[model samples]
Target: MSQGRMASGNDSSVTEFIVLGLTQQPELQLPLFFVFLGIYVVTVVGNIGLLILIGLNSHLHTPMYYFLFNLFFIDDCYSSVITPKMLMSFAKQIISYAEHMAQLYFFSFFVIDECCILTSMAYDRYVAICMPLLYKVTMSKQDCLILLVGAYEMGFVGAMAHTICMLKLIFCDGNIINYYMCDISPLLQLSCTSTYSNELVVFIVVGINVVVPSLTIAISYTLILSDILCIRSTVSRSKAFSTCSSHIIVVSLFFGSSAFMYLKPSPAGSLDQDKVFTVFYTIIGRMMNPFIYSLRNKDVQIALRL
Candidate 1:
């Protein structure tokens, strides 16, 4: 029933947070930092290089790549949100309530953006393969722009809603976040106030974010597969199936990690493994996407050659 620190009369003492990242062990810090630094380096290069490739090649400006262009942007920004903080981690960060909220907000924004963008991309592929002749008509430049805009909008709305709900809860127990980032689950675990409502909202929204998009993706690929199976030529079927399998792998890599992160119960005992999965989702996921989706791709190969 109590308000957040802002409205609570007794919360004047709690001004900032001490964020505890991955590990507290002295020996592990340097090694993990360096290792994540390498992962982040690859993330930066891969996403930026893919972006440039998509931009420069006029032939690559089709609807699929168009969706990918946005996806790449989201991937880069998404990793940037969490990885650098992990890399530059100190013993404990002096994070204000506002800063804490901002970090969680932006993190949620980009994470949800990735979800929506992936769904949009799946829809793009569905239209491209299942309804080839209607692909251009269905996914025009305007429609593509609308989809991109909607993805951003969905992210913004979800972030704002979560942040607002978060601000309503009081956090007097401790200002230390056990996880690397100010994620909702870890933060909720730290709340002193009754978190029934907060947990409910988290469950509902996260269910929608993970489940609905996952189902959409499943249905899209199912239709695409059914359409692919109807093709008669062996070479054509093999090629289409290969591309489809690659897409499935890329999608699985992301969704699997994401579901593990957001869909699980709150941080309990040793969260070391959770932190590792968090790293995979926030740091490694983006780095892998470009390679999974396009590293060996013929179009990207051609573009790079040019």
Candidate 2:
């Protein structure tokens, strides 16, 4: 493979990506596989159930729920990306390298998409809490659709940017990646060529996706806190806090694990540790999405009862 340049000078047709499994321990593989399989099952059911519940219950059709529907969709795609192959690897060792790249492409798409949608959700909450009178006006149905479209666009663009750079990276030597999937960092680490530009782009793109959304969530919650403090009644403050707490938890889990994974100056965080964190963000984090954000809400509870 040419160093940082694709054959025929076109970056799009690069054919394969190597995947490193979760562990090489023969004794541990089957047990770990079963654990992840169970987690994947829970993730699918939880996200699907949340989607159906919100769609069927008319009372849940507000902007909050609308954003949530997108969130569930993202989680569904996220879990689907790596879990099936992971399960298969336990049963059999050799996997298709091209298929692995395809999965990485799709998985990267949803990860970027989810970030944009979550940022929009944070902005929506800000408007609803800070400008309650204009809530419906600001987040109208058309606005929701536009945000959703923008999320998809941003996701594809970001993924394309990363994928293009990845195409330029040479993987001729030591095709074995240290991590379970085709994450940009692990992929870049395997490159025998100069990855300075690739590393910069990865940082910039991942930073934009992770930091922008995290900052939006932070600012929104800050304003929400101010608004809650201004309320005269303890009951109202408690209700407001309760409503916001769940979102805070979900945002923390998603962004926190992501930040931990990418923001480190060193990769001393052991591959095993990275695998654990990836599982948290990719699988366990998703299971917690519905539970932390929408499932426990009193409004959703009441809507479910009705």
Candidate 3:
């Protein structure tokens, strides 16, 4: 959490990092690898299946489903960044520091894109429920395209900034990442030079990542809730609530695990706990996302049926 132990120069003796996988027990390694392999397989299948379903279904071309498609795509990418290497960590290969930074770069990019996409989804819901008459004008095809582009644009910028900052840090020989992946926290713990500026940048970017979208979602849903409360018929209100329920679950899991993972200080003893929460947002969330949306969405279910 501090600036970290200071080193002499920007040059790093370490060309690569030895990734210590989840457990020390030899008995557990095989089991964990198989478990995560299963998860990664499911993640791939579910996301791809959902993508094909969306592409085939004419009725699924609305703003929310459009965003759901992006969500699934991001989830697929998000899990891909971490899981395959994680499963391979059982065999153990030395990966270059550059590869680690690349991993972090993509991770940051998709996570920010996801947050912004969810924010867009929240806005879509707000329009559908609170500004029904204006919804068409507010969320037209062009508007949806713009929002999606903006999300990726911001993700690119944030990822670039973080990756540049990380590249500046120096690591001595024998750098071993304590956890499964090259997340900001664990990676920062390895820097031989002062990481004050890098940590500050991470703090700022991750703060924006978590806080801004959360506020957008909360505000959107608040207005949505207020409108739903005003509805005269219970059936209408229930139907309205059904549309956003899956998004709510996805938001809660995404932001909750992410906030827990990044917002708090990483104590020395709790790296294992960190690894567990890491699995939640990174690996497990992707595997669950398609199922969550498909099951909760009547349109997607119907599309699958047809």
- Specify the highest-lDDT model's number: 3
The ten-residue window of minimal lDDT in model 3 covers: 1-10
Cα RMSD (angstroms) for every candidate in the order listed: 3.0, 3.6, 3.7
Please give the RMSD of candidate 3 to the true structure: 3.7
Collision pairs in model 1? none
TM-score top scorer: 3
lDDT of 1: 0.80
* Candidate structures ordered by lDDT, highest first: 3, 1, 2
Rate residue 63 of model 3 by lDDT.
93
Expressed as tens digits, the lDDT of each residue in 1-306 for candidate 2 is: 632224544332234544558888889988998898898898899899889988998888998889889999899988888788777766654544556556667877898898888888888878977898999999999999999999999889888887877777666555556667767767766666788777677678889999888888898889989998999999988987887787778888888888888777754457778888887898788877877765669987786677
**In candidate 2, how many Å is residue 73 off?**
0.8
For each candidate, the alpha-carbon lDDT, in order, equals 0.80, 0.79, 0.87
User: Which 10-residue window in model 1 sums to the lowest lDDT?
Assistant: 1-10
- Estimate, for each residue in 1-306, the C-alpha lDDT of model 3 and write its tens digit: 112223455543566788887887799999898899999999999999999999888888899889989999999999899999888788975677778889999999999999999999999999999999999999999999999999999899899989999888777634777788888887777777788888788778888878889988999999999999999999998999999899999999999998877777543337888988988889989899999998888888888888
- In model 2, the Cα lDDT at residue 277 comes to 88
How much is the lDDT of residue 130 in candidate 1? Answer: 82
Task: Please list the residue runs of candidate 1 whose C-alpha ends up more than 4 Å from where it truly belongs after superposition.
Answer: 1-13, 265-270
